[model samples]
Target: MVNSTTGNRKHFIYTLAATTLFISTYYLLLPVLPLYMQGMGGSKFKIGLIMGLFSASSLFLRPLAGQASDLKGPVKIMKWTILLYFITPFFYMTHSFVLVSIAQLFYGFTIGAFTISSATVITTSVPLEKVGQAIGIHSIALILAKGLAPTLGTLVHTVWGLYPLIAITVLFSFAALLVTWRLPEIKPASKPGDITFRQVLTYRMVWVCSLVLLSVTLTFGTIMTMLPLLALERNISQYSLFFTVNTLAVVATRLFTGRQDRLTQEALIAVSLLLIFLAVMLVSGSYSLITLIIAAIIYGLGYGAVYPALSTLVVLRTPSEIRGSAFGLFTAAFDIGVTLGSVWGGFSEYLGFKTIYFLASFSPVIGLICFVVFLHGENVWNKILMRNAAK
Candidate 1:
């Protein structure tokens, strides 16, 4: 079932540019955002609560966003989310913790809608053979933003103050909105009335995939929310460098690997999770910048490989008509992970940083087991059942 739907190349280009700009700004602010809250007299728990609540809002809204994308097409959702991106930075400038948390909540909504709709637009526009490659390309935009945003954000804050960084981010957000406004909207095959939640839920793999992704994302959450604070306490001056190195490794792996469809889906996922398992274990013991860099590289390798692989699997597993909902569900799972990880990191602080990171290492083990148990033998199970009935 290879499709020749390659004519939307220009629209694809526009989507990429728009998403990259928006995400770069968001990510640029992300590493130091918690620090901003702390400056406003917010404790780590309060900081985690704000971050968690944003993701929690995203977790709930993604399904509706996905359904909307499936019915009316991705354009409307994209427009609304980008507008949120454009407006949120103003709220961040308010210098009030409540206002900043509210802004972060808006960001959560932006993430849920944009990620699902944009991914749907990309995966559905390509041929099946190229889906994996397209996803890798789609991710490179974020990976590039991820690589540069932290170091740049941190450096900006270090040299000037937080206000200048917020100002630059707002500019990027507005630019993102402008670029996205000019793109053509492509409609899905079915009418809005025809879209239903059942369409997305019928495929059991969606559930399996989301669950596994959630578990793996827990590890990511811990790193993003906890690592900066931990490194600071340990007297590591360049914590942002850890993010820079991690993101660069992710970008390099995706670019160098080129095509990710060479191995079976499960095999690739298994290897990626195993790499993460090792990386987190390494992180738990890291005491120096060099040790963290080694851990970051390994983490990047796994993250770079697994995200696209998981996305490609979801696209292939679900039907085109309901694909937006599927992407929504998938992204929702991801948001949920980020939410819980932030809260967990905050709470785990009492457990001591080293012990907490050591505990976080086991999340991958649980995730890998879920992937194998749920996804690995359904076809064979069906065949065996059918044979027994015939006998």
Candidate 2:
């Protein structure tokens, strides 16, 4: 029993390390990729497509990956997926816009698989009661990596150029692969039986969670796809500061509120969305970098709290047998949101970036309204279940 406990601890540590490394490299690539595409003579439309392409591919592939994880075990899938990830940055070194876009498709598949697998492993390995805290800590590591990566990537790109940046990214990917090597296998609880994609599709909670994820992703997609361009158009050269401030705010808030036992998932979601709405409003009204930075900080706090809360809710709501599928569906729904936001933002260039922000600002309110109307019943039921179970 002691050996089993120690092994689980080691697995958790390794999983966290692997996830952090992978996320850091992924975030580092995100801000710079559009710039790189533009430098390679790609147009804004092309850049938007390139950005959307990753999500697009992931949207389609995630279900397959999830199914595979359940069939083949998460550890096997993670091992192969991480190796695929390790090969991705090398293609970026070719400096071909078309090739780079194709590479992003592969990148998406590998990442989507790796992420679903890791989540499956973690959910299965961690104790049910501690899942929230474990996932929160895991999220913090990923967020910290995201916060630090872009700044470091920007500096690397500025000083060392594309090839060197590619080298660095590849190195980080390799590190993630190495860390994942230590993760224990997670066997699926469900045997080869009557499970069907149609059955998973029919669950109402799945759709509810998916819609919520979509709304949040739509907001983030607008920020990711347009913020730098908006800054450039307005002659605000310190655009990276917005990212830095946003990341720092997220990191700080996650640390402070992450361990709190009293903060229910619903409460976190409600507060986070309200703050996000305010931040988006601030950003839409801002004409200067200072105001934008301030808004970014607020936005970060809101966004950071959101994922952990929503993730916990989804996992807790899902049965262990189908959790992998649920997460895959969640990921796919987010991609759909990203696709919508990117396409919408692109068209909104005719209406102006501020208009895009305005639209994005209202999306979370829609999500909040939907949750209140639809998901609150589930929350009430869950509370009743807990009360009864405790007796």
Candidate 3:
């Protein structure tokens, strides 16, 4: 038991470290890319198109990535994908939106594969009883990178310029590649190609959860694509601080609720959705840094808990043989939401940021309603899963 515990701890730390490093490469560009594209003669819609391409490509790759995770060890997918991160940054040096679009596509593929594999590692390898806490802790890596790297990226861009920022991003991706080498590659229980993506998606809860995740991710996608531009327009100079504050709030909330019983999933998910709705509404009305930070805190609180809770619900009920496929479909929903959010940025040229934000705020509300109306209750969801698992 002592040895197993020690090994789990080691696996956990390695996964977190690799993820933080890998994701930081992308987050570094998240805030800077909008401004960069705008400077390069891209309009708001064009900029959004380019930005959305990242998640669009990620959305396409998720199923293949998920399947690969189930067939081979996750570590193989992780290592090769991180290498794409290292190489793809060079494409951005061309300063062409076409090339930038190409780079974004590569990035989408890399992140989709890396994240699914890393998540598979955590969900499958960890003790089943502790999956909730493990997932919550695993999320900290994303939150940490999302918080700190944008600030650092913006700072690096300000001090040095775009080329240096790209170089720094390359360095981080390489570091992630190295760390991933240390991650243990636990084999999935299923034999190679035994499970199909169709089998996973056919499960009602999987697609339902995916749609619910999509609604929230749409809000997040809009925020990621638009918030920097919004802050710039309003003269909120320290806009990156929004990410930092949001990160802290998410981390705090995850820590507090990470150990809760899975039986309370419905309540946890509903409350999380409500908090996210309120946060988006706040952003639509904010004109100052303080308001943005406040919105971040609320958004963090809601966004932080919903993902892990929803994910835990799916994985707990899934059979071990197809967990990878289910997660692949589930996370692909995230990519769709983000893609839609980015596409919404195209409409900004017509609607303007405040109006766009105001409209986007309803996404989480839709998700909440879906959860309540479609899910009906936890008992219904569980029965569905239990029946499927038996087959």
Candidate 4:
């Protein structure tokens, strides 16, 4: 038993390390890609379209990726995913938007598989009661990459330019690939006959959690897709600070949440939606760097808490046999939200960025209301079940 516990602990750390390295490759491109697309003669909507394509493809593949992880083992799926990550960046160097766009699709394929598999590692390694804390710890990898890499990429872009940055991304992914070899091949706890994707999807808790996550990710997608150009257009200097500070706030909040047991998952999620709404409103109204920074901090705090809480809710409600499929759908919701936000932001350019942001601010409000209503209904249903049992 001690040996088993030690082995899981070691693999968990390896998963975190591998994830941080590989995911950094993607986040490193986020800030610079808009400018890269523009330099290739793409218009604002075109840039958005290209960016949206990545998530669109990812949205499509997550279910399959999840299923693959379940059947094939997450470590194997991760190895192939990292190889894809390593290969796709080379396509960006083609200097053609057509090729870059194609590369984005391939690149998009990697994240869903990588994320689903790595998340599976966490969910499987720990007990159900500790899933929330384990997920919180696991999220540090994403938070760090999302926070630090963009800033690093932007700095590199300013200094050495795009090619060098691409080289660095390739190197990081290669490193991630190497790290994956160290991970243990954890077999799924249940066999194929034990659960079905249909069962996973039919669980109301899965959809409810996924939709709530989708709501915030819409704001996330809009910001990541447009923030670089928006900052440039509005003359907001040092805009990279937004990503950096957002990272810090997220890290702080994660640490705070992981140590506490008092806050219900619903409460954490509710606070996240409210903060996201407030942050989007702030971003829409911002005229200067300081406002953006403040918005990032608030947004980070909210986002940091929500992801793990939602994951815990879903994982707790799911059986291990169907967890891969459930998480696939859960994370797919993220890509779809991002896809919609990016595409909408692009096409809505005529409405102005500020107006687009103002429109997106309402997504969280809608999410919060739905989340509460769903929980209330579920609670009522549970009570009815109890009453019937008593009779």
Top lDDT model: 4
lDDT of 2 by residue, 69-89 (tens): 777788888889878776677
* Global lDDT scores for all candidate models: 0.80, 0.77, 0.85, 0.87
Instruction: State model 3's lDDT.
Output: 0.85
* Ranking of models by lDDT: 4, 3, 1, 2
lDDT of 1: 0.80
Candidate 3 stretches greater than 4 Å from native: 1-4, 377-391
Weakest 10 consecutive residues of candidate 2 by summed lDDT:
254-263
Candidate 2 local accuracy as lDDT?
Answer: 0.77
Per-residue alpha-carbon lDDT of candidate 4 for residues 75-105, written as tens digits (9 for 90 to 100) = 8999999876666877888888888989899
Worst 10-residue lDDT window, candidate 3: 1-10
Give per-model CA RMSD. Answer: 3.1, 4.1, 2.3, 2.8
Clashing pairs in 3: none
TM-scores of all models? 0.92, 0.90, 0.95, 0.94
- lDDT by residue for model 1 (198-287), tens: 657666778778888898888888888778778878887787888888988898888755465635666878988999989988888888
Global fold similarity of model 2 (TM-score): 0.90
Between 1 and 4, whose TM-score is larger?
4
Per-model tally of clashing residue pairs: 0, 0, 0, 0
